[model samples]
Target: MPLKLQSTFPALSLFGVLATLLSLPGLFGCQFPPKIDHGRYTKLFSIFSTEYKYECDSGYTLVGEEKISCSDSVWSPAAPQCKALCRTPEIANGKLSVYKIHYIEPETVTVQCNTGYGVVGSERITCLENRTWYPEVPKCERKILAGCEQVLAGKHLMQCLPGSQDVKLALEVYKLSLEIDVLELERNKEKAFQEP
Candidate 1:
């Protein structure tokens, strides 16, 4: 009887352990992981509390809030509005050229030329949604007519003589005087030659 009781005891213990395990919900029925509530900003697993943020695409400007929130499982305040970026005047050879511009939108690249240089074509440009800008870059050129006044100043006296004195009469008088001097020298030379 003792030997039989010992064998039966082992079997009974095994049966009890199996019965306890089988009775659990995981064993008897399908057990699932806990479900998260998406209601009223509740439990957004991958996101943070209330606020969500998004960045605008290149060449686009954000017109509304950069951040949005979730409430009752729905996005709050809607997605931010986007607009096409405005342009700004461009500059070329900034070291030598000059330009002026106003930026109409954000993220627009503005360039300018240095002073004493002028630009050609449209100076203002903008980056578009297509990732491009219009009007391209302008060229820079040096300013013309640097020392014209100095040249004029040098010729001022020459011009004043024409107005003050009769040019034709003065020229004739000067020629006659030269002729007289030449005749005198020739006469002297002839007299010397004849005497010798």
Candidate 2:
């Protein structure tokens, strides 16, 4: 009996075998695993304290944390949340612009009045590590002017009345005359001490 010989696998035959093996999955009666829909799995995954990233809806903002990671295929207890952050207070007239932190934690803003007004506390106070304002709430009050009695001998005299103005003017004139007399006396003494 003559022995039948088998053909050796060549370059073309190797390629054909590979193609058949790869196509066999789709050709034969085989089924792939069901794909997981992210939306449907979202609620199921939320039960676990797994770190996740969630997008906020329009018109709504996200605060606190935005992203987190899961370890051991489980979310951490410190899950990131989306909260509303406090907005910066409206700046009043003659007030400086304080930093408005929408993403960060709440902060306090202190306003300082112009030079004419007296600032009750710090001009610009902000929240410290404790989330509390340094100076709390500050106020601005108008500076008080000195009264007539508080004025010095010839300082800041208002000309409210003509009679009072005349008296103030006379006092000023007498003070000027006294200064002139003193200067004259000093000159006379200096001349007397000078050599001939």
Candidate 3:
């Protein structure tokens, strides 16, 4: 009876050791949590009641819960989703050269004002990671041309004008000639005053 009791005792000890080793993982929370797409987690173990924080990658925004806690070997509140978005920019008196009507993050667009309007900001804008444009939206303002500048611009336009299209060119030339005549009269008046 003593020999049988010794053998049974050794067997019981071995079984106890095996059970403890098997349960060690549960005690230390050794299970790995599920991966979150487009995001990363901070905690190594997903033990019960352990919280894990998640962050989205560049050009992606987190949606739903930012942190999830493990419960019953499963993450609660589910993993947050990373969504990409790009807000469309608004520009007054200007137009954007975008390939897609719906904008996306990290995309580039060219901004230009209409004819006779001046741009007050950057001509190119890039979508940022936060779904906002890097530079502020450009503004287009009506160009106020000086009298001489208008005449000069008109002369340049005339150079490009076809010979057959004379109506518009002739009108601009007539206006310039009238301006020249008025300047000559003013000069003559100044000359008369100097002589006296």
Q: How close to the true structure is residue 28 of candidate 1, measured as C-alpha lDDT?
A: 25
Work out the TM-score per prediction. Answer: 0.32, 0.33, 0.39
Compared with the true structure, what per-residue lDDT tens digits does model 2 show for residues 54-142? 45443234443444444443333334433334444444434645655542334445586777677676777654433345555466776
Regions of model 3 farther than 4 Å from truth: 1-83, 148-185, 188-196
| Root-mean-square deviation of every model | 21.6, 18.0, 11.3
lDDT of 3 at 148: 66
Best by the TM-score measure = 3
lDDT of 1 at 32: 22
Compared with the true structure, the alpha-carbon lDDT of candidate 2 equals: 0.49
The ten-residue window of minimal lDDT in model 1 covers 33-42
**1-196, model 1: which lDDT tens digit per residue?**
6999998998999988876664333442334212211111122223124444555555565555556554554555666655555444334456312222423242444445567667665555565544355656566765546745544554563565655356556556656866897999999999999995
Question: Which 10 residues in a row give candidate 2 its minimum summed lDDT?
Answer: 32-41
lDDT of 3: 0.72
Q: Which scores better on TM-score, 1 or 2?
A: 2
Clashing pairs in 1: 40-72, 89-124, 91-111, 97-113, 97-114
The candidates, ranked best first by TM-score, are: 3, 2, 1
- Give the alpha carbon lDDT tens digit for every residue of 124-194 in model 3: 88876566777887888888777666567666777776785685767767788888999999999999999
Better of 1 and 2 by lDDT: 1
* 70: Cα error in model 1, Å: 5.0
